[model samples]
Target: MSTTKGHADRDVTEDLLDGVAGWGPVLCHLGIFELVPVTFDLGIPLVARWMNDPAVAAYWDLAGPEIRTTRHIRVQLHGDGRSVPCLGVLNGTPMSYWEIYRADLDQLARYYPALPQDTGIHLLIGAPEDRGRGVGGILLRAVTELVLDKRPACRQVVGEPDVRNASSRRVFRKAGFDFVAEVDLLSKRAALMIRDRLTLYPYEIPRFDGYS
Candidate 1:
């Protein structure tokens, strides 16, 4: 019964996302220091840094620190008409960075229906010095609020954290994302979490796909 209920919730959430994919704000990156507009040029380098961060690469599918890998991420950023918004995580002190991206609506719809109506948040604490300072929690909320402020079309923000990552799970839950699913993929297990826009800032809740 518990499993069935979980699936039911996910199905409904997906439907909700699909229903609102094209409704509001198109692209915006909300960060601590500034509210920057979205663009491909800004997105590529940030994603390159994210993909190459050893901390992030350890669990993700991307290769580490390779120029070629960065190039590949760059291509993806430009090839797709996706919007990537990156924010430097500075809360009266320096810490790691956080980025949120929106991909082509129809492509996202392939994996999860209604994904076009949302924006996905990917949080990375790559800077070792920033690891234990309670900054992850701050980055999570700030980024979400930023998205809500810039793009009112986003209805929900989603994240996929490995189930083994207890710290991250706590962060997402604190940010108000409910657990939607736990599944095995490419030999690892991960959790699907979503934050509702209505419960979020007052934006229209556009669909977004959560990717690492």
Candidate 2:
């Protein structure tokens, strides 16, 4: 929690991210670009836009007014100390929103066999314009590698997007994820998607200059 003065100092979150010395310089480049934390200031507006759009809002189950959605995003920024709230940035621009959480501590744990090192992900691209250009598959691959690399103990990464979202399921498949099963979650049928660490790295991913 660092001090940021309005939008003028919005980039201040960059400094707070840098100060985590234990993370080392490797974190400065997450596979390709930066996987920076979504700070208080940056999280509010960008998240509001993504969650309120008619095309996307249904995926997140955030309905009613804009203020309700904003509060939901704020609570995540404030109280979600268990997971990493991430911004997938290419060069310096934020391209997507991502969260990497411990499966044992996640709601999905009850539905599936929980493992000590399993990680769960929730993701959505922030811009509606970038929905179906095959950009999502690329972003999914990058974010998956970043999460696996960040957690050395993690052996598998999992996601459950609504089964009704056909395009999202395609992106997961393109990114090398396998469909496990469909489970009822949040009152919607979600397709369980899994990508093993080996699947993300083994012979699947090409060598990136900054990637370990």
Off by over 4 Å in 1: 1-31, 35-54, 61-63, 83-95, 103-115, 184-188, 201-212
As a whole number from 0 to 100, the lDDT of residue 20 in candidate 1 is: 22
Return the lDDT, model 2, position 117: 64
Clashing pairs in 2: none
For residue 69, give model 2's deviation from the true position in Å.
3.2
Encode model 1's per-residue lDDT on 49-145: one tens digit a residue.
6567666677655655556545544442343223333345243232344434452242333334444457766566656666656656655765676
Task: Give the Cα lDDT of each candidate.
Answer: 0.52, 0.65
Which RMSD values do the candidates have, in order?
10.6, 7.1
lDDT of 2: 0.65
TM-score of each: 0.61, 0.76
User: Model 1 TM-score?
Assistant: 0.61
> Which candidate number would show the highest TM-score if scored against the true structure?
2
